[model samples]
Target: MSEQKNTYRSIFLWGDKKIRPLEEGVRALVKEQFGLTEADLDQKYLYSDDEVKLDIAPALSEKQLNELQTICGNENVKTDDYNRALHAHGYFFGELLKLRKESIETPPDVVVYPKDEQEIVQLLAFAEKEKLAITPVGGRSSVTRGVETPQGGISLDLSENLNRILEVNEINHTVTVEPGIMGPVLEKHLNKMGYTCGHFPQSFEYSTVGGWVAARGAGQASTGYGKIEDMVLAMHVVTPVGIIQTKDYPASAEAWDLNKTFIGSEGCLGIITQVTLKIRPYRPKNTASASFIFKDFETATLMMRKAMQSEIGVPHLFRISDPVETETAFRINGFVNSMSDKFLKTLGYKNNSRCLMFVSIEGDKNYTLLVKKRMKKLAKKHHGFYIGGSPTKKWLKQRYESAYMRDPLMDAGIMTDTVETAVPWDKLIPLWKAVRTYLESREKSYVMVHISHVYENGANLYFTFLSPMKKGDEVEDYRVYHQGLIDTIHENGGSLSHHHGIGRALAPWMENEMGSTAMGLMQAVKDHLDPKGILNPGNTLGLRSKI
Candidate 1:
């Protein structure tokens, strides 16, 4: 493959391993957080199993392989075991454990990179005729194994030649681009043009625009810019039947919005080849942030709800870290802890018994100042103590690096994962307490939570958990632990997922999230669109027996 082709490397926990070994400083930091000694470190870090060899399925015949090669160039089609293995599992902890052990069960037969929309169309027809399944993937950053290859299929790696910024409608504040364009690259181009897509998922650096729309993602600043579903004005998807291009209009009175159906379809119905997204000029205004410490979780959440519901101004970035997460986050970052000692402790960080909320606002210089001022007033009303701006600024700088920590944590024999769900404000407290209580009772895991993407009526809760691997049964252990959380989410009336799409990990819960009738309608739609069941089977709709 050419150097440009290599530009499509995966990194969000699924790609190549290039992280430096735990340096002495990081070791010291971890020891401080987890209270481990040198011997303990050695014992924990030495956990490794013999690389369980992969049982790759048979490859395509020379003629069949040549047929695909002719469609999208020889270099774009790969049948090597290594490349196939890399595209298999997603970033899920269980998947990672399997990867670390080299125990992949379902590797794709062949991986193909289509150069353009026409090639994708041709490839889909070829797959249909050959009875081969197709899975569309970009950056392969799925944490739910959504991008995993089917039992036997070709993984259409759309990240290669299809990546480009096709057009920028400066007058209308929109940009049209091929689907495989990486998030950071697209954002950089928009920034150069004094505009931004403003969809900054944690996976921004490691994911693609197509993947964002596929997942219907929400960014850290979603309060101001809106979610991916809200940002997409139009999209073009290619399926076995034909191409679907949603209308580009500000408002539609149509009975059913087709774009909404395909926005979070998760590549089940079709392949998203091109997207026209709403963009905004770079906010060239003053920005300020402040941190608040609430005495309890209830008060913190209430304060968040009030801030979001108030008519003064909405903070571009808002987050409330629960007590356990607040402490854990500070403990892991030694520099931030040192700063707390010098400045924040006097302002109440010393207690370490409070939930933390970081609120940031950006707009007209004077308006931004007023927003921060109003935020401080609201916080005090809800029994919040100011902890200054250091923490919030620190959080902004390191927000994207949070995903990188997973690899090292796994290296240290710790199993870590995050799950998110949304619920209305009234039900937030119950869901929050239920999740923490359930996990605490089940596993010896550390759980932390934060609220983001706050709406007037509801908000999203993101929970992160970590625990030592249970010997050789890591996968089974994770399954049980994760199932408990999912149950809690559903019981408390939260959506099965807020931003993360329902990939294979949560496919079984589709019926629970959506009643049988609704789910049947979705299945009916899928069946009509992909009659052969050749598209991403066992994804959002779950695996089904042949009709």
Candidate 2:
């Protein structure tokens, strides 16, 4: 068979082939939100003039290099500067700064593409004997530099030739596929069979199934179908020592499901080669969606909690935005805001001080209507006014675009980033308040928040913040804002992350998040599986001091 062509580009930097320059509407939104003067708009956002200097890569003896090339074809092992540069940075703000400056500190000496699991086994064995580090990459969409290459190692590009579906067991409600398959490609194939994995993280267009499993992602509809961990039944991984494949049975009563242990290993444990994910038939015929406005954040939070407890119906798409986020969403663009303002006036409401909640249910028409009625009643108790589903439809249309908006915002001399965390219901309000208070206190900072992936016990809070660059020190400002939000999340009883994995960006806090004993146990697992520390280091457990 011919090789599968890459339909989408991996890198999304400002001047990359896949990115678009800032549009007028986006520019206007930035100016309005951060009060940027014309000078800020005129600021040319281009690669910094500083030349990227680098130390010579560790020398690989010609004999060893030739053996690696023979193992995986000449074209599969790349040593060019361009390919190595691409593998250096992910979408993290710190990495973006490096890209903007055209400066990469430490990049891989070579990048290797393995055609299949056997090839990966051979590659790992070779690297082990050679004492070379291997960092697994799929789609290269990690926001935390999870795939960053070690000082003198190889970056394994899995998205090249291992992106094919292996099996579709509709009878068993499961689909087995190679880990390198992109999300949209896999979803399209499943849709043809009237099935879906129901994993739709915003990065769906550019991420892969392996990446999803590695990061423990959550789709927008996670309220009903569950997160990636729940959707996975089993996985096939190639660790340094040996292959680790889990049981494919639907439910296992056997000693703790080993599959769950590998779901979010983030390449530290091994390279995930194949995944067997639980699939579901497409949604039913009938559907109902509504947007409601609440008087305050506390009321909206209470209403969502009540809905979670109610047995009327499961909310497949549930979301609630704080007043600040709702207001910013309304004012994101002039034309859009004008249209929404007209609609709000018709309902005798203003965007100010109104938290918005959107809930969608799918099933039979009668049951849909019944659930919506019950939802309305629950909202009414919290003084929430129904605003119909038009707004929700609009939201659905633009949900994925937010991820791409980061480039343009940064282009306009505005530093923009997002951080997410989860907390129990009792601590939810305090966490929300703490994050908002800290961000708003920063100079020129505009912060917005939304709650989603809510469960009976707690919910996830996702925050987006933007601020004008502080003269010539944008990186420092970004560090302050990014670290502040994460620090606040920890102090307020929130997880270090909700969907994003603990890459090097968050590795320092791993011990704090998972106490010393737990962290030590995790390190022990890594040491046992990868005795040579050949896997992705500085990720999860950080550079192994023992090694």
Candidate 3:
């Protein structure tokens, strides 16, 4: 096999281990936004150590190590400093700060690669007996610190061996797969069978099917394909108590929906061993793309709400960027002074005020064409100018690439992050203004907002903010900003998170968001399933005091 270029040691960096240089246009945009000169940009904001050095040692004894080796093979069980360091924390900004400085406080005692469900069952049993915390790691793509091994027992590395497409049910239009299967692997396998899962999150290249189910994640095309929860038909989870397998039924009045109990559990309830999801036939020829320029963010949202409620059909990828984001998009994509720019200006679409919308419909040719036509009519009725499908195509081509921009920005003395929340149509405008206002209030900050995964009653507002990094106080500054953003979202009547699950980052706010009674109920479920509290100690639900 060819050597792997990217590994967990370089988790601080995005994609490959190599540091990607910022594009000239992006660098210029950053400088303009942050009021920085060429000399200011020359200074590196963050520095990552070349060598992995964590002083912490494994807590597991030789006997315990042998026991794990017995469950998995000897080669599958790892105790090296690098492997432990790799599983110490996730891709959370705070964790990245620590990784860059090689200042990890706690590292997992051992990393285990279970080959199959049977091995997972055995490992869970062993963990229960030994009272060891086990954090199920899929792709290590968690930005919420969801995969951190705070309790330092074991890091269950599923992506190693427990990754395979188990079955493809053509008649039922569903596919069953092992939980460790990454999005690209599963999608490729499904595409070969002329079907698609239709879930394409920005982290699609690195995230896993189990991670999606565990976090209740949504893809970029969620407006049409629905979120991961909607696609998951059945699940087989291995809790500390026992295995709970939900039946695969189209619709059922089944007792209490155990599937939901574990869907967003974040490995607190159990480890998702296997999953069966609904799949759609691949129909790229039937896909339709369209773009529109609205006078402002509010107008674009109004048109989106109308389109969603019209019952005509929602687009597979419906998105509207607020004025700031629209301006940023224009600048970064070199849309300024272009023919499209002059044409838009001629039609009263001015920069810094005009919002940009991208629409994509996927279905049968007739259905897609009909939806596109009706959506276009709605846009026109709302004074939206049709800007052709080129923008949408451009966005589709660079959707995943945008995530890589964060690392380069961080390297150039700039701090960048994203926070998303969902709100009803009535509260969308207020929430948008409130969060945007708070973010922009910060000094040297550039805030961009966008609406995606739209619904009839509401839509998701995703905010991307960039500011000058406080070199020595990166994590502390991040905490302040992150907490303020969460508080603002809560105060403005927005969901804590739309797609990203309540990992450790959001665990503190769970009670405030879900209420005390609801939290108690969830706690009860967690206690019953994980009496020993060995599965992901500090995770979505909250920090557990036990093992």
lDDT of 2 by residue, 148-265 (tens): 7755588898888889999999789999999889988999999888888888888888789999999888999898888899999888999988999997897888898888778778
Q: Where's the lowest-lDDT run of ten residues in candidate 1?
A: 1-10
Q: Provide backbone clash counts, one per model.
A: 0, 0, 0
Q: Local distance difference test, per candidate?
A: 0.79, 0.79, 0.87
Tens digits of lDDT, candidate 1, 1-547 = 1111221122224333454355565567556656667665555342333432357654678888989999999999987766787677668766777766656688888889898999989998998888888889888888787888755588888888788999999888889999999988999999898888888888888788898999778899898788899989888999889998887888798788888989888888899999999997686447778898887788888888888888979988899988888776666565355854457567654545678899888767888899999999999998798879888998988887666667666767777789999999989989998988887775456788999788989999998877777767878988988988898899998998899878888888887777788878887888777777778775544645132
137 Cα displacement, candidate 1 (Å):
0.2
The predicted structure with the larger lDDT, 2 or 3, is 3
lDDT score of residue 264 within candidate 1: 84
Best by TM-score: 3
Q: What are the models' TM-scores?
A: 0.91, 0.92, 0.97
Which stretches in model 2 have alpha-carbon errors above 4 Å? 1-26, 47-58, 333-350, 363-367, 543-547
lDDT of 3 by residue, 174-232 (tens): 99999889888999889888999999989999889999999989999999999999999
Instruction: Name the TM-score of candidate 2.
Output: 0.92
